[model samples]
Target: MTLDIVRLLELTGWRAFDVDDRGRVLAGSDESGSMQLVELADGERTDLTALPGAVTGRYLPGERAVVVQHDSDGDERAQLSLLRLDRTGPAELADLEPLVDDPKHVHRLLDVLPGRIVYATNRRNGVDFDVVIRSARSTEEHVLYDGGGLVGEVAVSPDSRYAALTVPAAPALSDQLLLADTMPETRADALRELTDRRAAARHLHLDWLPDASGLIVTSDFGSDRTRIELLEPRSGRRHPLVTSDSCDLSGSLSPDGATLLVQANDDGATRLALHDARTGAHRLDVEPPTDGWCGHPMPAPVWSPDSRFVALSFSGPTAPGDVLLVEAATGRCHPLTFSAAQLTGEDPVEPTAHRIPARDGESIPCFRYAPHEPDSRTAGSAVVIIHGGPESQSVRAFSPIVQALAARGHTVLVPNVRGSTGYGKRWYSADDTRDRLESVADLADLHAWLPTIGVDPDRVALWGGSYGGYMVLAGLAFQSGRWAAGVDIVGISSLESFLRNTAGYRRAHREREYGSLTEDADFLRAASPLNRVSAIAAPLFVIHGANDPRVPLSEAEQVVAAVRDNDLECELHVYQDEGHGLAKRRNRLDAYPKALDFLARHLSG
Candidate 1:
């Protein structure tokens, strides 16, 4: 059965952020049309904030108010606002009291306590972020530490004495932990570096121990795979808490300080288990309804105040999205929300995992979504969907676009080329810096393997957004004859220009992965798809957000202009209200359907 592209795009999902003491969940949902902050309580959802883009929030101590983090359109310059729950009825947008409303700089909420809220901001200078602790009720705020890079994670000590900060290490794809004295009198003695700043490893601060003597951390310091570790900040002592032989592991300590919800990323699928927080001993394995993705977008598996149950968002091939409450002791699971109604009769396709052989003998992990009943008109046609981040992995999560394409009889192949995470550190960093093009080469290998899976080699199109978009263009330009058509969304066409035009704070971080602009100018230019646009053999559809801070709209304009200059079919759609992506539902409903139409017309032989 063919699914309506517009309706598929409109199907929404829920992500649980924080659960209050009263068993109320503060979540981000699109049940109200657009992604908004809503309160889930007593079998009903109360809208907290409404808008086009998704809003994240945390419940204040007493459940009387919430701290909301929202961005304008998709600009990603998030601002923090407080919404009081002392009203008799549902709250409106005007009810939000801005705590930090600066549109120019980015303000991210880290944690919320009784009377204070901690956040990271690039307000001082646009490039470096300073961790700040501000009073929840007043304008009193203090700069806790000025960690010259992005703060990846932060966990306040149990006794509220120190704040463990995760900052980017000197090298790319690595992070270090810094312990800050939250109440220190002298700025000189306020910050103490716990992890080695020069180490080529990544460390994430999950939560503090109940005694405040140590911290729960996930680090890949000595191993290629990340593992749970307990580190003492005072005496510089640390030990492994949890270890996995083949997969990376991470977990969160419960509020009662007894159990740890351990999650293992085994080749893109999650293995949920409960472990002893203190001894790191294996306890019970909590199985979800299906073998799918869980705790995505982070800040999930939230333990209830009494520590009886844990709540996390789950999404599988058939499940659109729902919140699952798992009993800690028995490992029983129950769904708090259901999204199956969104697709009344449609049976979403489940992907089969495969390791396709690459040219270099390296195996590229991929997920293939085959159509249940193939449409003869589009038979043998396939779409290769590339994931962005190059660091992000394409797990078994529900993707409406992928399902819609499959329902339309288009075989969709999602590959985690070379640099995708979840597999290991070596895999993610394999294509970094000077080795960037090696990843694009993986695309060529993927195309060559298309015919082996019954897909027509001449009818496969490339589809991706962001870094994935860059791969789509690179596949067409670098290996022009391999791909039939391409759909690029907010992609980087010119690596040189992208490095030069990207947001100031992001440029330095991105340069670490894409190579230095000043030193590697020649390499950047030679590798850019824009420079070789003349070689592109496929028709192109370029979609971009006008306010995108990362790639910028110029990336789209230049490529489209270049493609059109060659007298090739290049269509461009620029959304003025969006920034990095199609975060808003309405924009997605319009763009994705049109994109599918473009694919249908070009792929239908």
Candidate 2:
């Protein structure tokens, strides 16, 4: 599945924030960098927004409209808009209207019901999010509950009488639930402490069973990885349903609420399980076509309006992310779109999932891609692609760049370093604050381990975005001689500056992982890669989104400037219309080519 650079780029597509009520896939195709929304049924795509940043939208539950999420210049403060599509109309943008267009606030549409929407926004005071019930037809809105902490992830009951909110238990990064009554007679302001922080669940996912008996929630209450439980809204007692050694979460509930889809991260790849909602019985287990793919964050498996099929998007080593419709009854999967309009050539060179031993004797898991087309040499170069989130895992997802590099004779190693998710809580929190460099050492260890696996040591390169970008800088600084080059994408240079400069709303959550500036200023600076620029002995390539609020543009600016002052070869690219990463295809088309050329020039095995 090694596609040509441009062809590989063109073939990658992902499911949008939407799967029409009919379950017909409306995806963001990769042909254009702007993320054009394509109706996968017919391969027709239409631009939904004018912005260049990333775009994710959901088709309103029962309406002929969609609610699109976008932010200006890559700032985390996003704007929401409603586009009531008119297939009969002549123009695409004709029926669009401003839904929530505030500059200082971040608006997230949690759930859309028959005639209303459950939304969370920091517009209340620009600090913490407040859950609100807004009329789908009018501007009428009512504050359901105002919690001091992060009042996000609003899940509305089927009858539209109740809403569930996830409030962060800060410092620990765990979360609890807040139940709000949204019925006409019931007091909207009356909120109940649905769950407590004493028994914390790091990831709280909620979904109302069809009859609204209570909620089907996935929590880490009594298990290391998350487990599915049925929470009785009245008694506030939970009945355990599905528990596993791997990370598991509740997926969509059937219309009648009988079948509940559950996705679990068994090792690095995902396994799909279907449970009987009423009995808490595991009825069936279904894995996607690909053995390893991402199912946690975005484009999760969605159930059809009929509840007979579950639509899921996944990416493997050679395959770009593809959408599959699974038949719930028969356990059969049918491809909606193979993460694109078409996937050309033979099966992609599937990656081998293996564990590399770490210095601390812990096992670090990774997906290794050996190039299908290697150079005419006994040994070839290697590249380690790091994932962001520090809370995120680098599964065997379809990444065009990774596949392209492998095709170009470079072995791509995507490691799930210590701090990454899917490995359980202890491993995920292993790289907190001062211990962050240990995660970089995990990469260095992978670099050192490459020789044993037949990769040339001197030609290895480091590549990552955001926190992973920070890893790039950390590798270049702390392990100067270990790499041939480094490619950093929107990485942080200073933890202290990032904490202070990031949007006011996101600082607290970030501090829970990275050290807090108020307490760890010196340690933060010492840990910052920009402070150790003199030790970076490799050619560096930096990419950033000017509107990136998490790692501000200044983070990239300072590093590029400082690295240039060291009299080394440092190439910096800043996209004005992009943020954090290249959301717009035009920006990616320009940026990635430079990346390929840079890797080729520096990684000469």
Candidate 3:
């Protein structure tokens, strides 16, 4: 039976953001066509914000209101607004009390206390993000740390006396920790650097200890994998709370400060456990109903104020995303949101993990999804989907697009090439800076290895968004004959133009991964797919958000124009209301079906 692409894409997933003391959950759900903020309590759901674009929020300390962060279209310059729980129904844009509404600069709400809220903003100079502490009641605000670089994470102490911040040290691979005095008026020396820049490693998830004695930090300072550490900011003493030899461990201290929730990422699967916060002793192992990926890069598990329960979102190959609540004492997990119940079918197809040997003797880890039902039209056809974030890994999570492709009888392969995180520190940094093209070579290696899996190389099509989109164009241009068609979405055409025209705040950070324009302009131009547009022989389809701050709309425009000048079949679809990717369902319904049609036309001989 052929699955309706529209129905498959419409299946909703939920994400838990914050859980209050009374166990009221602040979450994001797409049940209403677009992702909107909703408060879940006592088996009832109340829509909190019906504003434009997807909304994410955290509950205020009192649970009477929420701090909602919303952006226009898909433009990620999110503005902060306060929405009270006392509303009779779903609150509209007019009902939200604007907290920070500067459309020109980006404002990220970090942490909230009883009387104040702390956020990182580039309002000062529009390039550097300064940690700003603002009064929740008034307009008074002051910069807590104006040092430099992108502020990655921020946490305010329970007593509101101190603040902790983490900034990127080696871009995606490592971070430097900084501790600042919140009450700087009384002290001459305010900010202190806890980690040395020379020995920088990945340091993040800043959860301050309840008593302000130290912090439960997640860092891979002296090891290959990340572990939880108890760091005394004042004395600079460190103690390991969680350790793993093969997998990277991420942990969060419970609100009561008595327990620690630790999650280990072994390849793509997630293993969650609990520990004694003070002694680092193992307590209980949390077992979800199915094997799935959880924690980090996603919203971290949020603990209830009383520390009796922890709420987190979980997803797997067969499971769409749902918020889960785990009791701390018994380790019993219950699903708060059953998003899969709405879908009408057997479970989505599960992917099998495979290791394909590359030409350089390196093994590429990939997941393959076979068709649920075979179709003659797409027989021997395969889609090689690349993930965005050359730094991110394609984990075992529910993807409507991946499912939709398989339902149409196309073999889908998702590979974690070099530079994709979750394997180890060395693997992620393998394609950094000048070594960028090395990751793209992994695509070529995958193409050559396709015959062994019964997938015809001549029928293979490249598909991806963002950085993955760049890989699609690169594979089609550099290895033109290897692929039949390409679909690029908000992807960069020229690394030189991407670095030069990208938002100011993003340039310095992105430079750490992709080479710097000032020094590596020549190398960037040589590596860009647009530089070798004449070499591309495959038909191409491009989709882009006009307001994309990361990969500008000009990228899609220039590449499509150049490819068409070669008398090639290249089509471009621009969504004026979208940013980096399509957020609205209406745009997705039109864009994806068209892209699939393009693939069908090119893939069928």
Candidate 4:
């Protein structure tokens, strides 16, 4: 019988990203296969970007127009296009024109003001991102600051007099806030550190308290967990407003600036609460229905324009993410979406969380899903899917891929290895630079652990995307004889080339996670899979997007070539209309069947 994998893959939903000043929701959904812009208003849903490929969009403040990032296939470099949202009556064709037509470099819109637009681009310095300020009224633009890899998050004052920039301090390398003049006529130094180096290394600028009197930010200085602090940008004064026991704190100050929407992650589950931004007193708790994240547009608690309700995307182990409108005053919750109820398919196999100890005796948390029917393929065969972001943890989010694999009769285990997030800051930073390959070692622990669960050691396959894809390669390279087959989706072949060829916008920060080529080339070379591809004994299914900006096509191309040269079983599938991951439904339908067939042919021996 053919595996009905496509039906399982299609039963997932999206998280809300952008909400304009008018409170209309803009989400990137794969309901139609490709990533299309969706607008949610008055409980009515509309597909805005009905075009081809993936088109991510953000609202331009007053609901005037939307700035969308569209690229050819999966190439990370995108052209900023303007889709007029203020059109009246019968919608004319959105004459999509380039907002800032620099298709060669990544243009990130930081702050959009009435007359000025602040953005960052590496057009000039291919090595570092530079802040560029362009006038909204005209095509004229100028450099705001050329600080090399220092400037990141940008916050503007309500008066439009100044802009607060987050700068990474050297040596200690902590995040510090810096102030810069925004007024065109103002003759200031343009940029100056707003806070001293003694401050926290990281500060998530939440929002400028009403009238821009103070800035409320989440900082971790002198604390184990992040806490909200109000900072007097000009005077360099700071005071704590809210704190957490251990969970990472996030949320924003209300538009009225009276109450703070506080959301903290307790063991990867979000707990929502409201606190007085001024007094730091707890108002009420808006506990999340499930113990999962508040969803995308990561600042947590995305507030509506009126601030009457906070938009939250909550998910569970079984349910895909759905919107929740949590009333700010009473902390009472109302379900804004019934879409999560629409996901109907096979009997869902629930995952049980396990604290399996690795070879080093360090506790590794993972979620294991067992098949209902324990036939030969179901009992003996298994697959381990690694979450990408060596820093990102494998949380119990709504994952159709995991469920689909279990549906196809494979016991699935997702391990939160040494370098995953939601554990703590230390574990999150443990596998940086040279220690990354050790994460591949954690795969060995997973490989050994499978036998204890009745799965044959030889029947287990390894699969992952992005950094997880890198892990898949490392598994087949270093631990060759263990996995039955390896599925690499947009994974890195060489850590060195990834650091060099990745889009300029993501290169520096990515280097922070995976070592820099300038300083850690020797160690990176020793850890790369390209040098060890000769050892891969298992069948390999390599998949990549042609426009993948993060891992790049060259990584997939070279690895496939090297694998084929080794006279081993290898399959390479590239989707010309996808990027990074399989964002389109059509591509998924095409690719997943091939994957299911590949696993069945290799694992059912």
Of 1 and 4, which scores higher on lDDT?
Answer: 1
**Residue pairs whose backbone atoms clash in candidate 3:** none
Q: Name the TM-score of candidate 1.
A: 0.97
Worst 10 residues of 3 by lDDT: 289-298
Give the distance in Å from residue 546's predicted Cα in candidate 4 to where it truly belongs. Answer: 1.9
User: Can you write out model 3's per-residue Cα lDDT over 1-605, one digit (the tens) per residue?
Assistant: 34557876777878999888777888889877688988788999887777778888887786588888888988889888888888788888899888888998899999887766788898888889999887767888878898888899998888877888988775556788988897776556788889886664888788988898999998888887889999998899999988989998898888779999998886687888889999999999886754454423256888988898888987776566788888899787778888667664564788888998998899998999998777898978999999999888898888888888888889999999998988878788888888888999999999999999888889999999999999999998899799999999999999999999999999988987888888888999999999999999999999999999999999999999999999999999999999999999889999999998899898875
Clashing pairs in 1: none
lDDT of 4: 0.74
Model 2: lowest-lDDT 10 consecutive positions? 87-96
Model 3 segments beyond 4 Å from truth? 170-172, 185-188, 290-297
Q: CA lDDT, every prediction? A: 0.85, 0.75, 0.86, 0.74
Residue-level lDDT of model 4, residues 468-536, one tens digit each, is: 999999999998788889899999989998888877656766776677788899988889898998998
Candidate 3, residue 298: how far the Cα is off, in Å: 2.8
Query: Evaluated with lDDT, which candidate comes out highest?
Result: 3
Residue 587's lDDT within candidate 1 is 83
lDDT of 2 by residue, 1-605 (tens): 44657767666566644565455665665555555455545444454444445666777777777777767666777777777766543223334577777877888877776666677888877777888777767898888877666664778787777788887765354677877886545464578877776654664667887777888887777666777888898898888877777564545667678887777776666777787878777888775564444343245666656677676766655556666767788677676665533565444666788899888798889988888767764247888999998888877567788877887788888899988877777787688777878898898778778888888898899999999999889999989898999999999887878888887777866776787788888989888888898999999999998778778899998989999998999999988877778877667778898898899888874
For each candidate, give its TM-score against the true structure: 0.97, 0.92, 0.97, 0.89
Positional deviation of 238 in candidate 2, in angstroms? Answer: 2.2
Better structure of 3 and 4 per lDDT: 3
